[model samples]
Target: MLLDALLFQLGYNAALVMIGAGLLGLAAGMAGTFLFLRKRALVSDAISHATLPGIAVAFIVMEAFGGDGRSLAGLLIGAICASALGLAAVTYLGNRTRLSEDAAIGAVLSVFFGFGIVLLTVIQAFGYGRQSGLEGFLLGSTAGMLRSDATLIAVSAALTCAIVLLMRRPLTVAAFDPGFARVSGQRPDWAEAVLMAVVLAVTVVGLKVVGLILIVALLIIPPVAARFWSDQSTHVLWISSIIGGLAGYFGAALSAIAPDLPTGPIIVLCAFGLFLVSFLFAPERGVLASVLRHFRFRRDVHMRQGLLALAQGHPIFEDLTLKLLIRAGFASADGVPTDTGRARAAKALRDEARWREVRGDPAFERAAARYDGLTDLSDVLTEDQLREVDARIGPPVGAA
Candidate 1:
């Protein structure tokens, strides 16, 4: 069943759903990157919740006017308007009041969402036509959706992605450095408004598929997971889009296989799965790589400490340190130094003495900072510098 759905054999509606959702994810991921960089992720949440009132209000107004209350275009427009109002309120409070942006966001999100709920209740009480589906916008519903609606979502998503691409440079500049962006002929406020507009578009479009509640996850999870794969913003942005697209395609397919499950949550779960994989196994930043680096560091530290202990003729008591010495052929099982062990120990002792002298002289402060007890002095200082430091130590004890 899963294979059939994944292969697009589940039927036309399933295929349409998958394609539309894939486009949505791709756009959301890219837009979400700007939102993430903007450090205003909470703003997306506020906008999404704020949109709900617009949807409900649009429905009520349309019903009163004898128009189709469930019109996608009307609902989305209402959502956009409400989102804009919410953004304005957030901006006003942030700029004028002592309250922080987060606090303003929290207030707007609660009020707008609560008002939406009240409107929904009033619609139900008034016994509106086919008003049952209105609640689906809270969590999303693809079942029994009209072909026209799916097409609209797909087209909107594609257009949103195109718009975002065209404005990428300015959005990025504004997100990271508003002051620099202003100097570069970009109005920081307008660039930021553009970013909010993109996010608002994504949220409004997503309401029919992922719903207002889960839409924020679609906007955030992909970029966060992509960040683990690369340090560069460009790489992260592309990777995030790919990840979002894959999640949407597979999540829609998976949801199709089990009609009882909702597509929004399934898509979110798919994104989280990607995040978990990246966290545990990404090349440079994963838990497995961190563990490997830690083990390697420990080995080096043990070997260095064991060698020095042998040089000072101190008893090797630590089990790991003694085992390391024996494994490296630096000491016998009895903890006595081999000839090679003696040579290494001598070098370790001489390096320690050099570090001691370097630490005492303020002139070598920068060079001395390189001493981590595991590093070789030769690695930190040039030959001439090493020769100068060594001259201070003189010849060996049996010197002629």
Candidate 2:
């Protein structure tokens, strides 16, 4: 059953819902990347929560006017208007007053969400006409959706993705380096406005699919997950979009497997699963990679120290260092240097001497700055320089 849904073997309505959800996911991922980069992701939360009042008010107004209050278009328009107002308030408070943007987001998020909840309560209490489906907007419901609603969602989501792609360059520049963007003739203010506008559109379009309550996760999780896969900005953008799309498509299908399953939370859970995989296994930045790098570094440190101790005729007391030396064929099991060990020890001793000379010499200051104790002297200097350093230390006292 899961496989069939994923393959779109379900009916036409199910296919349409899947397409709409996937597109919404792509737009959210792209738009979310900019917000994450800008450190203003809370703006999406404020706008989403703010749309609730508009939805409730639109329903009441439509019912009073003797029109179908369940119209998707009317509800969305109201959501847009209300969200715009909320965004403006946040901008005003953040810029015109001492409160920071984050603080403004927090205030707007709490107040508007509370007011929206109150409005929802009023509607239920009064039993407004045809108010059966309004609660669907809270957590998203695509089950038994009209064809027009699905089409509208698909088109809106596509347009949102197109707009985000068109403006990605400037948005990225503004996010990473506003000063550089200014120098390049891109107004930081305009870039900020564009980002907000994009996020607003995503929130509005996503209301019926991912819902206002969980939409911010769609915007945030993909980009964060993609970060684990690559350091390049461009790579992250495409990777995040792909992850978001997969989550949406799979989540929608999985929801169809059971009568009680919802599309929104399922999508979020799918995204989190992807994030978990990236966090644990990504070759560049994952937890496993970090652990392996640490172990390799520790081994290298032990090997270097073991060789140095052998060169100086010092007692090797560290068990790990002795193990490393023996494993590398540098020392006998009894801890005495083998012929190969003696050669490596002499080289390590001379390298240390060369480093000391270079560090103290004014002429070698720049080269010395790159020095680490583990680096061989031959790697850092020419034969002439090595000879000069070796001459100062005289011949090796214990040469074979």
Candidate 3:
């Protein structure tokens, strides 16, 4: 009875955590799709680090404004301010300097983080009675969040979701073909700026559950995994959101059960694990699919080489001699290609009998060549390509 009651209560708490994480995950996934498409994935990481300065400034501002020792509103405003500054810096560096986009991101990330660290040290030295709680923002701990914090996250998530849905068509056009979008009067520049703002907002909300240091993992891993499962943008968005939200809820629950475990690391691990699975086995993009494709191509190359070899000599009237076909791995010593080894090789192509059947045709006579490891389409060819190939064979003997 006691265990049952405990299970019941755990389920209830899990539901609450899931609700908040679900909202946050949906926003992160939608915004992250565009980020990945735009090749601006690292921008999220830069903004997350930049928030440190904002948190420090928020604390300083809260003390000046005189209300509570800590102020969520101040933190939000300060973080947004710092994020805007970082964005401007990245833009300036990319436009005015020779730095690449990633380089600009790295530079801004390091400089702003260094400044935040200095501010942090100063706060500690002054020995303020109030705890800064800034460290929690670094790696995240859901235990530090309350009902009010959840409410803020929920509201931010709703705004992000609304904006993304409304801007879907323009964003898709810009991502797939920016030049075309611009020519069509889509105004991709303003769309890009608005998209970045949504990313920033989502990052801010994530800070409470996953922290600034690890939040980018949430934004990146889910979409990466989702891409392996679906090519369509809409399916990718929904699947990624589901995957991300599940990871967050499980990470939080695990931390709740084992008080020593950190929420941020656990959540990141969950998302990364899913990415690995997707990369290895997600249908079309999986490791298995690529290997199969390579095997099929190699087999086709070998068969085409064999056909060219026979054509160079003369067209055979009937089936290939057992010796010749066996040597080609299409038959056995008994003039039959039924051995398991031969079957395996044939399967790698199409079928063993099928190749022999094609070999008997007079037309197949010209298909074979000297087997010098290239297709020998000497007789059957396109006029334009044939002229190019014949020219490459070099000038007629006396013409040289």
Candidate 4:
């Protein structure tokens, strides 16, 4: 049953919805990479909330024109127009006023979304026949998605992907270093405009699947989760796209299985789950990995300090430290420095001496003068060379 559902063997309607949702995920993930890198992640949120007014206006305008207010194309056109206006407002506020980009985003998001709520209430009061299902666009409902809607989503997603692929290099350059790109004769502003257009397109197309409220999650989460897995831009893009597609596929499938559930929140929750997993377990970067690396570093430093103390003929204070050093072949069972132990101790001493010199310690300067014209202890000294300095210095000051 699981395999069949996964492979889309569970009826044509379910398959269509799943495919559309997956494609939407793929496109959002790809475009979101540039958005994430440019630090415009919240811009997507503003744009999405901004679309709500567009959708409401589109429905009202269609009803006035004696057409069905729920016509998908008219609704989408309204969404696009309203979103563009919102984008312009945000840009204007950011450029012309003292508002920062985030402030502008927050302003537009709240104001436009508030206006949309008012408009929705007005529409509800007007008693339009098609207005009943209009609220579905708020939280999204895939149960109402027809084959045509799925096809439209698929085409839009494909177009968005194609644009990203064709302009990948320029987009990457602009995203990473716009000033350098402009100096190098590339039109960074133009590339950025094109990228924003792609974002708008994806946002518009995704309205039916995830709605305006949760759509930003689709744009932001996958790329963030993918970041935990790779540092390279190309790899991040691929991983993000895969994560997004999987989230869409599984979220839609699960929602379909449980007919009472809404699809948009499910999809966002699935993406968030993937993000949590990445945060906890990704190699080298995850929480567990970072903690392990910290402990390992402390252990190595502790063992190195023990070796240094032994070289200075100081008493070993910890019996476990002595046992560990002997087991590692750095000391004899009698707690005395073997040849390997002496060599390791000399290296540790040189490292400490170099660090002290870098830190401008007067003691290290005086010690250096005793080593026959050595002005800087920048390089590691031989065992004999280090021993001569150590003898002159008379064992680091605190050694017991």
Candidate 5:
């Protein structure tokens, strides 16, 4: 029964809506990679909030003109206009005033959202027809999504994806280093404009499925989560898109089954869940991985230190440390250095002496400071040069 409900029992409307939401997620995730790289994640929040007043105003204008006040086209047109204006305001404020991009984003988000609330109030008091559904734009309501709405979302998402793919190279260059891109004769401003357009399109389409408040999460979380898994921007982009699409698909499916839950928050929660998982378990970067790496590094350092002490006839501090060295073949059962252990200890002491000398140089102070508490000196000093230094100075006093 459960399997049938999941695979075969879904009605046509539910399937279409789910597909549309998934596509919207895919586009948002793709475009969001650039936005995340550029550190413009909050721009989507500003644009989405700014669209609220535009939606209300569009409905008012349509009613005044004797047309359907709830026309999707008219509402989307208003949303675009308002979102553009908000973008312009953010750019202007950031460039012309002392306000930074974050400050400008906050200012625009609050003012525009407040104005939208006022407009919504006016519509409720004096508008001719039902304005009840208009509030859905704030929190999102996918229940009323029609086949036409789904088709429109799919088309918009496809176009956005195509544009991103075509502009990938220049966009990536600009995203990482605008100055270098300009030096290479690429117009970063043009690339930024194109990116903003893509963000606007995604934001506008997402309003119905995820709503204005939560749509920014759709844009920001997937890329951030993907970043935990890879350092390459190309890998991040694909992973982010997959995570976003899955979030949308599964969230919509669950909502369809429940029939009482809101789709927007569920989608956001799914993305958040993925982010949390990545934060904890991603190889090399996740919290658990980082902790394990630190533990291994500390253990290695202690073992190397104990080997040096044993070579110099110094006291070995811990029984466990000695056992670890023996287990690793650096020492014998009697806690004496083996042939390999003596050579390793000599090299370790020599490298440490070289590292100390290099770190003391004024020229290397800054660079050496970056490796505080590091056990291996081989990374900074080559074996050939360290051997030369060892020949000249010999190992430290007791490290023979």
Candidate 6:
């Protein structure tokens, strides 16, 4: 019964965290997709760090206006203001100074963060009530979160995600080819601004959990992971959102249960783990799977080469046999290459040829050249198919 209760409680908390973190993740992932595609990922990072000064300045302004209460509203207002300023500064430096974009982001980030730090130090020195509480922004704490914070995060995420969905076509076009988007009169700049707003909002909302230091991980890892699974931009966005959301909630729950566990690192670790898994095991792009496929393909190719050599009367000793072809399944248990195995290999090569016909790739070249202009590789290919493959391969040596 005790174990059941513990498990039950874990499930309950995990569910709640999942709902909130999932929203956060969706927001980050959706917005991050565009940022990654547009190559503005660094700018997002600079904005996240730059929001610190905005939060500090908002606090200062609130105090001056007799609003000493460190309310969420005050923080939001400050964060927005600071983030806008940072964006402006980055844009200005990029336009005017000799500094490159990365250098500009670094400069704006350092300067704004330094200013915020100075203000925070002053607030601490004065021993302002709950002034130390703002430090949570720098190193996020689930302990400080209220239900309202989650609501804010959810609402912001929803709005941002909705905007992304609505503008998917134009935004995708712009990401792939901004010049073309402009020629098509799509207002790529405006599309980019809208996307940047989503990114900024996600950063602000996620600050309650992942903090500024590691929020960029949420914006980067999930989309990158999703890329391994698909070539379509829409699928990439959806998959990235799911992966990012799972990471966020897991991070939040871990931080809640283990007081020592830092939320930022935990969230980052979860996203990174997903990325690593995708890198190693994703069906089409996984390193291990691709390498295995490549090995099998090479083995089959070498086996076919050996068989073609045999058909052309190339001398072969029993002991000097084709071991590589045997290992690749092109030879039988009797240490002799079987017609059935050769046929199967030919079929595989034909399928690859079809893939090339549709996609036009390197696989097509290899597939066409596999039989040295002899076999069409298809099981029941007609004379037309043979002619097509032969036509694709070009004449054999001295057959001009």
Clashes of each: 0, 0, 7, 0, 0, 0
Comparing 1 and 5 on TM-score, the stronger one: 1
Tens-place lDDT digits, model 3, residues 166-279: 898888889889999999999899789888999999888888778888888888888888999998987887778777876776666666665466678888887788888888
Which residue ranges in model 6 land beyond 4 Å of their true spot?
1-18, 315-321, 325-382, 385-400
Per-prediction TM-score: 0.89, 0.93, 0.75, 0.84, 0.84, 0.81
Error of 5 at 238 (Å): 0.9
Tens digits of per-residue lDDT for model 4, 322-355: 8778888988888888888887777666556654
In model 4, how many backbone clashes occur?
0
Estimate the overall C-alpha local distance difference test score of candidate 2: 0.89
Ranking by lDDT: 2, 1, 5, 4, 6, 3
lDDT of each: 0.88, 0.89, 0.72, 0.83, 0.85, 0.74
From the highest TM-score down, the ranking of the candidates is: 2, 1, 5, 4, 6, 3
Among the numbered candidates, top lDDT falls to 2
lDDT of 6 by residue, 83-152 (tens): 8789888988988889888999999888888988998888788777665577777866666566677677
Looking at model 2, residue 376 earns an lDDT score of 82
**Candidate 5: tens digits of C-alpha lDDT, residues 48-88:** 99999999899899888989887777898999999999999
lDDT of 2 by residue, 62-131 (tens): 8889888899999999999999999999999999999999999999988998988998999899986555
Q: Among all windows of ten consecutive residues in candidate 2, which has the lowest summed lDDT? A: 254-263
Superior by lDDT: candidate 1 or candidate 5:
1
Q: What is the lDDT of candidate 5?
A: 0.85
Regions of model 2 farther than 4 Å from truth:
358-369, 377-399
The deviation in Å at residue 124 for candidate 1 is: 1.3
Best by TM-score: 2
Q: Tell me which residue pairs clash in candidate 5.
A: none
Which candidate model has the greater lDDT, 4 or 6?
4
